[model samples]
Target: MAAEGKINPMHQFTINQIGPKLEIAGYNISFTNSALWMVLALVVIWLFMLGGMKRELVPGRWQMAVEGVTGFIRNMIDTNIGPEGRRYTPYLFSLFTFILISNLLGMLPLAIVPGFHAFTTTSHFSITGLLALMSFAIVLVVGFWRHGFHFFALFLPKGTPAFMVPVIIPIEIISFLVRPFSLLLRLFVAMISGHILMEVFSSFIVNGLGSSSAIGFGVSLLSFVFIVGIGALEILVCALQAYVFALLTSLYLNDAINLH
Candidate 1:
């Protein structure tokens, strides 16, 4: 139980070790809550994907949903990356589903269950950082592969003043380098901020009941209503963030593929 006199809103984000740590070579890797949640999120995603596999004359709701998502991503890629982007469906689709599930899972009130709670992987910088790096790597590898050494030319745009080449080149290079960091911060901050607000309001409910006063109870009721609204907003944020991440990813791929 939480301490009687104080509530630690940040405590929910803690990563607890679930069992004995194992050493592989010189490094110790302990299974943790964050890792457990990630596995759970993947399982949920896998089950949902299986929903798309039912072959029938009339499609079920699950199959329709799966088809809808598939079409949306396909259209997004075509609009953003053109025909060549078709080759990237597997990566883009997986990215969208993983982040989408991870965000939604974190919004669930499952903390009461032992060894389970919504672990917002996107909120953790480490996870986001790794994703950002992978995105960057994809862009770098594909850019160079397609255009050879000319990929370096992306740093300088056409029609620029010859005299400003040095300044503009470095600036563009810095901006390109910052794409992953930008992606990392946008999703991480949104997830963390929304969850923190939910946590704070939840504590208000506890503190309200403890007071045993009419005004406290009334305020607690108000907090409850507000928290519900926040929860709905967080749900919207989950979908929006996932879409934005995928959209930005498509844009990045366009830049890499066409140097736009």
Candidate 2:
């Protein structure tokens, strides 16, 4: 239920058509706010990467920032997946930066500017699920391409007793299958929950302030404090979730590469 003059928290997650809707071959491929944000994220990433292309002896702020993020991802890959991981640095770097930027952009107070609203794409499972599936697909392709049928051996550890093969293999297989869903839900739920908290508090502040009683003012003040605190925490969650996603992805790739 929604109160009058109060915006629904979940309204932020709604997908709206950006232009005229179009149907082709029984498929609806109309452009949407989500699609626009994804494209915008990619453009932002490209511009950010341009910062590193200058290759100067004394790096400027932009260059240093780009190098810092690149080095961070490189170090993470090296630590998790070893030298072979170097090859995957570009992909993982893009993945981390995209998610980080998108999450941060969603937190922008754009709604304050009439007709402009910040939308978080990661809050949707479809987007996160696609990212997870892409990573999982890479793992599968690499595992099979390098090891062929030996990839199935991932389900059985080296030290498992022969008698426990049935139980251990099934458990491991199930766990392996659940990886994508875990990745999807972790990001989707985290992003959505934080936004919802902020929105709910925002509504409280607005509704409370509109009332004339002292209790209303007190409630409004408290809600404002909560919003500020939650906003700060949400910023941290944005970066942390992106890092966790990249880290888990690299670890999963390590399993495929090392078979351990």
Candidate 3:
């Protein structure tokens, strides 16, 4: 049995089986919360788009909200990537919506306790890794689509001397491979850290107040107030992280498309 006062927020990262397990080579194939959240993110994006499409001109509250979000992403892409990169708007928009929704949804007290008790997909490295891989794939595809074989020349900066090519080229290649790692780390760390802090503080308040009479109650009250403030900050973080992720993705695409 679990301890009465102990909290286990990290349990959110567990993978619960949904069906008969299948062995693929030597790997265990099973359904998990990570997969569930990925699907939920996609569904949320699809529904938002569909709602916006349904009310193209005579917009309702939902439509207006959807348009405002799309417009913000449009401006972000335009500013960072320019008109030539407008073709990638759908992808950028999708990425932003999916992440934003996932982050916010994780904050909500849902049937499956978002971001807690085997319910958090965003905390899993595999999910973040796949997302980073997708972003890299987009960069590569767009680069090849725009510049063909000439894109390889981007590794060699124009001012580089022949003697320095040996040194700089390998460095550039490593940097290119590390792009996905950076993206994965940024998103994963931000999301996981925020939720973990919130959980820890909340558990503190619950346990602290429950343990004593007056002083504990006062301390718990203070902790609750602090948690509320942190909640607001987390909202900002959720939106900012989503925006930063999409913005950096756009910048990366721009680099690939307009490679030197």
- RMSD of candidates 1 onward, in order: 1.6, 1.3, 2.9
Top lDDT model: 2
lDDT of each: 0.88, 0.93, 0.80
Q: Arrange candidates, best TM-score first.
A: 2, 1, 3
lDDT of 2 by residue, 1-260 (tens): 25577678888899999889899998999999999998888989999887677999999999999999999999999999999999999889989999999999899999888767899999999999999999999999989988999999999999999999989999999999999999999999999999999999988888898897799999999999999999999999999999999999999999999896
Rank the candidate models, highest lDDT first. 2, 1, 3
Summarize candidate 3's per-residue lDDT along 1-260 as a digit string, tens digits.
Answer: 02566877665556777677778989987775667777877797888878877755678988898889889988987888888888888888888887888887777655244434425555667777887899999899888888899989778988999999999999998998999999888888988887778777777787788878788788788888988988899889888888888988988987897785
lDDT of 3: 0.80
TM-score of 3: 0.87
Tens-place lDDT digits, model 1, residues 106-202:
9888877975566788889898888878888999999999999999888989888999998999999999988999998999999999988988888
- Specify the poorest-scoring 10-residue window by lDDT in model 1: 1-10
Misplaced by over 4 Å in model 2 are 1-3
Model 1 off-target regions past 4 Å?
A: 113-116
Residue 8 displacement in candidate 3 (angstroms): 1.7
